[model samples]
Target: MEEIIKVEKLTKTYGSRKAVSNMNLSVNRGTAFALLGENGAGKSTAIECILGTKRADSGNVSVLGYDPAADRKTLFEKVGVQFQENNYQEKIIVTELCEVTASLYRKTAEPEYLLEKFGILDKLKSPVEELSGGQKQRLSVVLALLPEPEVVFLDELTTGLDTKARRAVWKTLSELKEKGLTILMTSHFMEEVEALCDEICILKQGETVFYGAVDDAIRNSPCNKLEDAYLWYTDMEGTADENF
Candidate 1:
């Protein structure tokens, strides 16, 4: 498989603390990759460095064959991102927000199509602030897809979704992956990772403890399930479900 995203010796620090230390990972084209870690395990910092939102203290990072820190203008045209939280203008309606977002890209998918596909078309006239948490989450995904990007980064992809909505989003993403869209996502849900990811990198204290197939992770650990394997690898073996 072609390598689409690469990071080598990526490091980031805030004061005396190293948020990401010598991180290295490669994401293949047309495959979904998951970044797994406990809270404050440096996943967010790693992503920021990769996206060039935050400059790394040291290391090389590339996305789509371009240096993200130096070639962001060109690389962003083919990349999309859906953050865990999005803040829209007060009283901004869905259609207005969509139009504004569409104007930023040279070419974009039809807003109505994406909205309906995510089951939020009826909220077109509703103020973004008025939408429910799940509705807002779906809207964020729709906005991210508007650019028809080749690679997308999703932070906590199904955080606010219920079971049915989560499954629906998973199906949509799975289809997109099948159609050759590369996905990089972070989610605490082991089931979601098992369902959507082809490969995974588990981070611990800003370092990669394991990077491989989910089945391999299970085999490597003393646990038979991905969730248990994750707990074992992260050193939270006896923790309860709430930790996830």
Candidate 2:
């Protein structure tokens, strides 16, 4: 399979703290890849470095064969992103926000089509501040997807969503994956990863502890669930320094 994203010996530092140390990751085309880590575990920092929003102190990154730092303008045109916290102007109506987002890209899906697909068509006139958390998240996703990107970076896409809302988002994402869109996502929900990700990378203390197929990781664990496998892997001896 063709690789869509790659990071090699990536490192980022803030003064004396190494936010990400010697991290490596690779995501293939048409695959849903998960980046897992606890708070302050360098997940966000790594993402920033990969997205060209933050510079890595050391190492290299490539997305769709383009260097983010050198080709950010072109990169941004081909990729979409949804941050963990999406903040829109309080009074901007959903349709207006979507329109603004769509205008930025050379090619984009119709705002109404995206909104309807996410089950937020009725929110066309709703202000950002008035929508529920789930609705806001859906809107953020729709904005990210307006460009019809080949690769998407989603950070905590379902952070505050209820079960039904979460499932709805998951179904949309699954459909995108089936259509051959590459996705790199981060979430605290193990079940979400299990359901969507074909491969996962677990970060511990700014380092990768595990990177492999989801089923293989689960099979190696004492329990059948990914949550248990995650715990077991993180607690394993020398996990932080383990390569692959």
On TM-score, the leading prediction is 1
Clashes by residue pair, model 2? none
Q: Candidate 2, after superposition: displacement of residue 86 in Å?
A: 1.8
- In candidate 1, clashing pairs total 0
Instruction: In model 2, state the lDDT of residue 56.
Output: 96
* Cα-based lDDT at residue 13, candidate 2: 90
After TM-score superposition, what is the CA distance of residue 48 in candidate 2 from its true location, in Å? 0.4
Runs of candidate 2 exceeding 4 Å displacement: 236-244
Q: Over all chains combined, what TM-score does candidate 2 have? A: 0.94
Q: After superposition, how far is residue 125 of candidate 2 from its true place, in Å?
A: 1.2
- Considering every candidate listed, which one attains the maximal lDDT? 1
Q: How close is candidate 1 to the true structure, as a TM-score?
A: 0.95
Task: Tell me each candidate's TM-score.
Answer: 0.95, 0.94
Report the C-alpha lDDT of model 1 over 65-136, residue by residue, as the tens digit.
Answer: 999989999987899999998988859989999999999999999999888888899999999989999999
In order of listing, the candidates' clash counts read 0, 0
Model 2, position 197: C-alpha lDDT score: 94
